[model samples]
Target: MRFSHTGPAPARRDDWQTLKTLWPYVWAFRGRVTLAFACLLVAKLANVSTPIYLKDLIDGLGMPSTQLTVPLAALAGYGLARLMTGVFGELRDALFARVTQGSIQQVASRVFRHLLALSLRFHMGRRTGGLTRDIERGTKGIGFLLNFTVFNVLPTLLEIAMVTGVLLWRYDWIFAALTLATIAAYVLFTLKVTERRMVYRRTMNTLDSQANGKAIDALLNYETVKYFGNETYESRRYDHDMRGWVDSAVRNQVSLNLLNMGQGLIITIGMTALLWQSARGVVLGRMTVGDVVLVSAYLTQLYAPLNFLGFVYREIKHALADMERMFDLLGHHQEVADRPGATVLQADQASLSFDAVDFGYQADRQILHQVSFSVPAGGSLAVVGSSGAGKSTLSRLLFRFYDPTAGAVRINGRDIRDYTQDSVRAHIGIVPQDTVLFNDTIGYNIAYGRPGATQDEVIEAARAAHIHDFVASLPQGYDTPVGERGLKLSGGEKQRVAIARALLKSPPILVFDEATSALDTRTERAIQDQLDRIAQGRTTLIIAHRLSTIVHADHILVLEGGRVVEQGTHDALLARDGRYARMWELQQSRTAETP
Candidate 1:
């Protein structure tokens, strides 16, 4: 089977747009940012002045031995300049550290929360491995972009300006003109080459995410792979993605080598031309020996960061690409949103109704057609149907996971859309057919029903679900770790844990979707008793595969092909001797054959 994200595509973004999106996060710490820049300015100024002092010291030492003074002041000034440069640069980094980390935290937090707020539809179609990889790379990119752009890129430009101005003031225009032209050419060349090379980087990132997604997907379904004896097949599938990644990475490295060679050549020629001019000036007696030393010193200072500038620019571009994908996640439209001024659902005992409801996961096929149903306050409704009869869709609609295509789902006589989603959900609890537990302690999963619930409350819930005795038999009991997706426990045990969680929630409304399908007949009967006792005076909706579980429900709905075919209590439906009777007879015959 092929895997792909079926969700809506993410929007494309430009580098400037991505940077603009990130600026506010960094700017929130403007005070620290301003201070860091102050330190940077001092450091760069001191660094530029170091060369001047060195030039003076060299020229002073050229005098005859008898006429020469110690020239201790120039030496000391040079030493102090170097020291200040080191001290303030370090101080700049220290001041800016919090801003960098803080912005990363804020952006990552926002992305995480927004993901949770997104509709279930979006998440259902997403790959967990690929999605998480995107987040990891995006946050890392933010740090690189901020540090390099501020410290390396900005500082390099400042130093270049200072060096060129000094060169023009002390020497002929030829020197300054050469420096400016070389810088302009180097920047232009780096930008053009890096732009072309970005395709390789993007391809590598895409293939890497795909490879990770496949590996994680296979690992999560390890049992299936073993049952089919397809370990080699899985490896080949993963290697397919890795093969693409390898090709892209090699191409990316090759392009990088080309860029480095071009940049090195530019630096070499510029250095040669500038020094030749200085040497000619000294030979012609138009300039002093110290002037050549000054020129060389300034060139050394300027070229160091200029070469680094090329590197910083390339990485910043890569960071922008990563951030663009992350920000696209932010830009994804929310499929379901609460209306402006939506009110809180305040009913203590909620009544649910689906009024002339019509819905489908896709427009091409309708799952339910004009279905209408209601469960009054403190009443219980059980719905039974064959597979693909739209039985589970009712619970999803009632919980407002998806709104009806043509009608309204109401709670307490008001449309659910008029209330906040959180408020509406807070009033209901559910035990899903497929119970998935977190990779945490059993106690933690139980307490998740009502966060901050005391240990006693957790134990009481487990006892109610009839799983307490089994749990007590374990070496670690409530603290026992449930491995990934609760695979360490049997299906029945996981179901019992889910039932206990729902019981702990104690909401006014409850939904049990095939809640006891995994349990044995004896355990099912025992848990069913507890369910009936707790469901008293609460509105409950049960979607069941076992007819025996819903025999005592106050009202029963029989659905076939997404339409309600019959509705009545257990005795009344049996008396009708139609669809419900036949289903009951079939289940009874199957149970008898088990012995």
Candidate 2:
């Protein structure tokens, strides 16, 4: 049921380590980043320099009759400087856009590719919805981090330093000292509170992912839920997770409010003290009205970015959290990987053999115990067994989905492990028992057998499987969309589509793993006739539970408890009166009992 991921999983890493891992992506766009840094510097300088102009203009306008009045040109220059500050800042963002976008694109693409390269086990264990959410949130976080870290955080610090130096130069050292102390306290408080709130944020994110995962899982299995009439049960389960999310989300909001209020209180107190000191100096005749105004102007400029700093800081932390989980998924190690220097499967003769293979899905539970079998080029072999007798494991071994704990599977006299997995798979065609189609048009699903196949070729394949007339009877024909997992199609129809797909693939080695299990007796017999015609002089491996399907196989294997208890031609095996004989009798009895 699982698709193959051909590459090894990257080493597992912590979440925050993703930031470090992301440097290469960022560095890839280094030229633009450097230009953005220059713009940032120009913008900061323009911003701070404009406040000084305002200070000079205030002082000039407020001069006594004995002093010269502020020039109209001076006022115009001040306005121009303010406008230039915004222009430079915007230019910085524009220049940096590519770096941000390219970095996000690189990371997202790598993660997506890694998912495809991961082992079936890792993917089967993950929830599609949750994994997708992590990727979504992570990419968004990259944008936030890039913008805020490059623009907001850096600018705020630069502006604060400028304000302090100006205060010390124009006013008393006391003003600069108090300003530094107040900012340090504010920053410390914000950092501590934001750090504490991280726990709540983390919890809310986890709950949200869980809720999304549950909702998607339920929706994908919508038919099953309705079949069991468990709509209310599903609703209750979803609501239960939602309630927990609501609680966590509410707490997260409350903590944010508390942090915001605390930050506001500190800033308010600092502004009051700063303005009060300037007023005291003016009243004592040590400073003028213009000086007080200038001091206030500088403080306001300093506070603007400082306030923005709080928001930028919180956003960056949240982004880091999202990136962490996403990167962890990217770091997953593939349990199944190709050996070094492996070459493409030659498949010259298309013969297959299980050389004393011992295998298991889990180490403690062996599925095949030193089972060995082979089919010569252009021969047919049918394996029949009870449900737990490991009939399907043979096909998986030949495909190299998993390695045997002991021995190996060989194709054309070369160990399957010695060839590239993709090439090995490319040479084999399978009509699986449970054929799950994509939510797409009928033609699209059919064409998936051989990508880029011509329309005529698709129709011919469908005709070969005896499903073309049924499809043509529909209004949309091949264009009709199959519902999720082809739920709109009948079981027999799905099997036919699968058969057509394998036929289209035209691989040298073919596996029919319960290919007709879903069909009624009439359809089975009809398809079996076509299958028998097509299977001639081609290496074919049949894994079937229904003995009737394999009655005339060139060679038959009756496996019991992972060991082949009997093997021979149908007539020859029946003549022996062994396990194969008993199974054949049981299937015939079941067929006779069916009304």
Candidate 3:
């Protein structure tokens, strides 16, 4: 239930490198990219030629001594130039569409797959809300970066260069200098301001993520909030988080408007200077009216790309900031990765032993110390202890969720560490104290234990767990919906479903971690009978709290504060009148008084 983002963000020096990671994905479709560039060149050439045709058409029509016949060829050429511009532009987009879409898919999918590969400790510390939001933004960021970089930024620069060159050759050097100087200033200003504005957007995104986490946490625990009558408290907390986002968003908007106005002013100054020079030349009879019109057309055409650059500059900065979160998630390494040439676990006999094992989640808080136990082939061991006696830690260690700090756990005289985690876990089945199912059909959750299991096989496992009759009686039968964490089902019913799942797995070693804690006394007795029958040939480790439930165990070990204080059969411990004997007496007294 705890949630936090990794604090102390990396410095801005890493932002450019984050975007650089996408190059390989983009490069994968190099053939299409080359064709798209060719189309881009053709499109710009057509666009630049449109003004030349217009100038010529005007000059021809405005001739004083023209013949009576109309100049249809000039009019057709002018129209064709305009039409070709649009056609080539669209063709470029069509060719490059695959590159943009593919890059987004690969990057998003790679990041998601990497998150799954991370260890349980990383997942425990993650906030689901913020993690999902970062992915969503990062997916969108990839598309934005590819489209603008290829279609907008490159094309705009090409158009500006062509325009500047045409003006200097046809008119004067002054026209080219004014155009180049204005473009240089506009680009520099936009970049500086956009970088400054990124701080506001980065803050806004952080607050947005916090708000999302608060809301998701509240809804997931809806029953708890309602039981405590704290609905208003949760709402107030979410609203407080959103208020910071609102303020940051407003500042982001204001800075954006300022950026737009400054870009507009520079374009205006550059346009006016170029136009005044053209008109002055026409008045002095140094240039034709057609020349003046051509110059005006060139400045107008060039300014169009400059305006687009202003927008592109701002969006690119935002996109890069969004992608930074995803890159960080992908860069995290697993804390308990398997050794380089790890082998598979050969689970014959399935004997398990913890050889003087010691472990701690942190340096200062040890959960287990010198804990040692063994279960022989086809034998059973019951672990009994109070909370914080490290009963649960034993199960996690057996599953290799964490490596032991001292000593080792072995199976068949081989260290479990020598086997890959996947291979080691494949042979073990656990029915935990708390069973949380996915928001899916009951049959689907049951099938999760052994994927591709036949319908008859699923029904047979359910029958063994004593839940088949209940499931078959429902209107939807096996298709009954188990809401989030299986909340729609009663506590006893959920535990039955978990039993059915574990039974379906049929692992050589079975673990019952307080498996019947949620059932009533009668139901518990009946299920325990079934479990005892099923444990005949399996290596079973039963971790239980109630003494009456585990009286039939082959061996029992009582743990006190991470150390074993007693070990013997159920009758031997009781006959000795030790800690197990005292706990058994206390539980029997309560059981007799209850009914």
TM-score of every candidate: 0.97, 0.92, 0.94
Indicate whether candidate 2 or candidate 3 has the larger TM-score: 3
Better of 1 and 2 by TM-score: 1
Q: Please, what are the lDDT tens digits per residue for candidate 2 over residues 246-282?
A: 8878888898899899999998988989999999999
Q: Among these predicted structures, which one has the highest lDDT? A: 1
Candidate 1: stretches off by over 4 Å: 1-12
lDDT of 2 at 160: 88
**Model 3 agreement with the true structure over 81-101: per-residue lDDT tens digits:** 888889989998998999999
Off by over 4 Å in 2: 1-16, 64-73, 284-290
Candidate 3: misplaced stretches above 4 Å?
Answer: 1-13, 65-81, 346-349
Model 1 compared with the native: what TM-score? 0.97
After TM-score superposition, the amount by which residue 263's alpha carbon in candidate 3 deviates from its true location, in angstroms, is: 1.6
Best by TM-score: 1
Pairs that collide in candidate 3 are: none
> Considering only N, C-alpha and C atoms within 3 Å, which residue pairs clash in candidate 2?
9-333, 9-334
